[model samples]
Target: MTEDNGGWIVFQRRFDGSTDFYRNWTAYTNGFGDIDAEFYLGNQIIFEITKDENVELRVDLVDKTGESGYAKYSYFSISGPEDFYRLYVNGYSGNAGDSLMYHSGQRFTTFDEDNDLLASNNCAEMYHGAWWYQSCHHSNLNGEYGNDDYGSGPNWYHWRGHYYALNSTRMMIRVRRY
Candidate 1:
């Protein structure tokens, strides 16, 4: 949660490569890892929380060089399992750049579930992580921790290149104020 900013609940956090984000669909649906270290707070829970509210999504990122940036969306939400938990994010405002907008309306994809737009490829299997991939992605937060080999690493492409590994990342959400 934020101390000075709004009450943001951090649902996804990664650092130190303690937890593996390259997981199957079930693992992503139910979520995995400890909240204090690294974790993804289940897609189901996220859908439940954001479905009825005008929520804001914030992604804070720190590169390997210690440079920090953030991406904030005024309206963010996702659909249920029937829809593959399709992403819906808009009203971008932040320093990290609007990388997520490219994925808006895209369905989430895991190694076991090929819901991405690319018909000939499994983005999750190729990228080493699951995400709301639109022909792959512009941001890959849930990826190979601290390893950029084969373009598999936690990265926000608008902030850093695809081959650069990030130092830390956090995805948070809160009810929009106005």
Candidate 2:
């Protein structure tokens, strides 16, 4: 888990996600500056979106050079815990149904809906982050886990490392800051 100078758990589940969490977030979404500026390659990225948060992470694809919300139709499989309440503490509040939605199509309620209410809906980079449900596991999948490769070399996140291809989307990660 990535912690702030205050020693609070700011990010986790993956190092790359905790490392570049805010940099890639605002860089692609252009949400906040002071919050985004706080994060360095090794520092934790902190943002104040709500008093009670349990955000869900979204992994998708986008152009190498583009803004947020540019996902392709290609299917990919990701694993996560099916139960979020397991991670909850006192006052840790959020939707109870998000754990199941994380494995299927989006809820389409505005930008982010039932699935991951706070999902970035973009493709920034790998191991992208969001306030996932307390139970979303990284490997023990509860739903579909897609496996497709558009590039060669090594394997990661179930896809070959091909970040961008013309208008075609490249594999990337994004966090849904609540």
Q: Give the candidate number with the greatest lDDT.
A: 1
Q: Please state every model's RMSD to the true fold in angstroms.
A: 1.1, 15.6
lDDT per residue, candidate 1, 107-149, as tens digits?
A: 9999999999998999998989999998888988998897886
Q: Please, what is the whole-model Cα lDDT of each candidate in the order they appear? A: 0.90, 0.23
Please report, as a residue range, the 10-residue window in candidate 2 with the lowest summed lDDT. 136-145
Candidate with maximal TM-score: 1
Q: Which stretches in model 2 have alpha-carbon errors above 4 Å?
A: 1-34, 38-62, 70-100, 103-178
How does model 2 fare in lDDT? 0.23
